[model samples]
Target: MKQGARGSAEAGDRSPVAAVRVPAQPRAVDVDRERGIVSGAVRGEHTHSEQPLPRPRSAVQRSSVRGQILDALRTALVTGELRPGEVYSGPGLGERFGVSATPVREAMQQLALEGAVEVVPNRGFRVVERGTRELAELAEVRALIEVPVMLRLARSVPAERWAELWPLAEATVRAAASGCRATYAESDRAFHRALLALAGNEQLVQIAEDLHRRAQWPLVGRAAGRGRGRGELVADAAEHMALLEALIARDVDVVRVLVGEHFAGAV
Candidate 1:
């Protein structure tokens, strides 16, 4: 089972936010690898009678291959390309991605550890099902960790440091306005990751990110069904900017309230 954060501090006495270090965007090589795997069949490079044909095993970089497959699978999970309760076999996904099954299995195991998938006895892995109750529980946990941390950062971090996050915040809003769930989700994660990193606690940032990723999984199907429209996503983006502004202004009250409201309505 995953562990939650322990202990809390008063926001007023917390230290200022530190310099933010945003993760690098996914490289084109990763995208090209996934595209080759997923689209190879359509392009007649790795297909036979409409069936996917796996690429030959070569002395390619194993670590890079695994990372790319992981990225592709994560995207599928977040975009509803992989559905809840759907069983996906390692070899099956491997063939779809035009790679061998080893890397695919490795990738799935990592996802299983993250609670995104569960291993079956003889079958492959299944996407874990999440409903309203699960979502609420996730939101509550997020609020517990994020509310206090954000409030502390808002009080401590310099306004100039908070201002540095505007580009990421704006990117998220733009993604939402574009009405693309995948783009918005990626941007949303980036924005939050940047914000939380200011707390200068790596472990806390990781835990919060895990919760955020879990929260996003349930939205895939909804996003696909139009259950979450562009307006709602845009509103979400706007709230992110508002929260950043509040943090910059050192309004702990507004920051606290915004953090709670953000988690409550995140789904």
Candidate 2:
């Protein structure tokens, strides 16, 4: 089967396979002396049977298949299509996604390492449970690590850089207002990534990337339906503009305050 496409049998499960099996008849029968009834008519009729399906591929057949699986899974993660603590069938997903089992298994392992999924002994992989409290804690962690890094960068980033970065930030806010959650969310992340790049610290950028990856898991889109008014978007733009101003002034303290307030308020 092509990677990421469902199999025909799985696409339409119309019947059970066990109902047509043939059983052997007993060559001899035993009679119950007291009840005068035959007790052993056929021993084959009581036999249990099982048929195992073939294992799906553990690796992708095509180079691009892995990335395709990743993107689909990422969307599902962000949209809550795969909720916390929900177990998924690797082969079943391969079937649904119209891919071989291999890419799904590989993707699941990567997600597990990211704390998006957990491996169980026998039950297999399940989505990691994340409570509102957990999200609040993540916000706190982001504030701690990110705010400082952003402030430091803001103090050094040139005004010309802001001209370039502001567009991404403005797009993020505008996307949110238009209820395009994925676009807004991705742009929001990109805006922070560009700001972090200004820090010139590779390690800090890497840490920020990991944190943002986790942040995408819980998602904030459906909530966008509540509406981010034009006024709200303008206010967010103002915040970004203020950060740029702080950068131009090389005011670390002001940048720090602004960065902290932005994330804290995002909650």
Candidate 3:
């Protein structure tokens, strides 16, 4: 029956059946690409807090929600907005961030992997509190790793390379004067990275930056009970410039001394 029916339909059946044409339909819009998704350009009845946090840098626009949240949480950790030993729930933070808890939880787990926080079973993630001794040890280790590198770069690198870093050192100074610890801390890191990069050791830069970041955890308002405040940051930023100057002059003695003083005050 199937073969006979197929033969009759194809070979020219005189049946009076007419073919019906289907109409084309509009394509569906991807929900994530809709206006409110990416930029602050979201248009709708969203209240202020419901909007995404402003990302001043264009590079941040390319980041996923998880990466953005990670950065935001890191900034919170540094600025002491997220206090040490405090437990924060993913859903609660997600609401503040105008997103779902999935991204927040993902970001928090990344922080956990970085040793910045620890999971609290069903409760939430608790910020890891560092004692003075831990911070001191981190600073000591960082100094031991970086001081010799700086001295070597100063002695071997051309003066032109040191001059090229003036902008980075100056950036730290500007960030310090702006009274934003997070900003200054970033600039401070950039300067150190650029300095060590002259030695052509990629691993050295990564390790040094890791220690620097750990030293910066949960500072708890540098002016409050245990805060170091803006003055100390400004002084530290100024040392970057001073250290660069010594590096350019190829003053290994001065570079070693400056590097020592800088790390000594890191804790």
Top TM-score prediction, candidate number: 3
- Model 2 residue 195 CA deviation in Å: 0.5
Off by over 4 Å in 3: 1-63, 219-224
Q: Over 4 Å off in model 1, which ranges?
A: 1-63, 219-227
**Cα deviation in Å at residue 125, candidate 3?**
0.4
Q: In angstroms, how far off is 264's CA in candidate 3?
A: 0.4
User: For residues 81-154, could you state the per-residue lDDT of candidate 3 as single tens digits?
Assistant: 67777777654454445455556778999999888999876556788877777778999999889987887788
Which residue pairs in model 1 clash with each other? 16-156, 17-157
Total colliding residue pairs, candidate 3: 2
Weakest 10 consecutive residues, lDDT, candidate 1?
1-10
Go through the candidates in order and give the clash count of each. 2, 9, 2
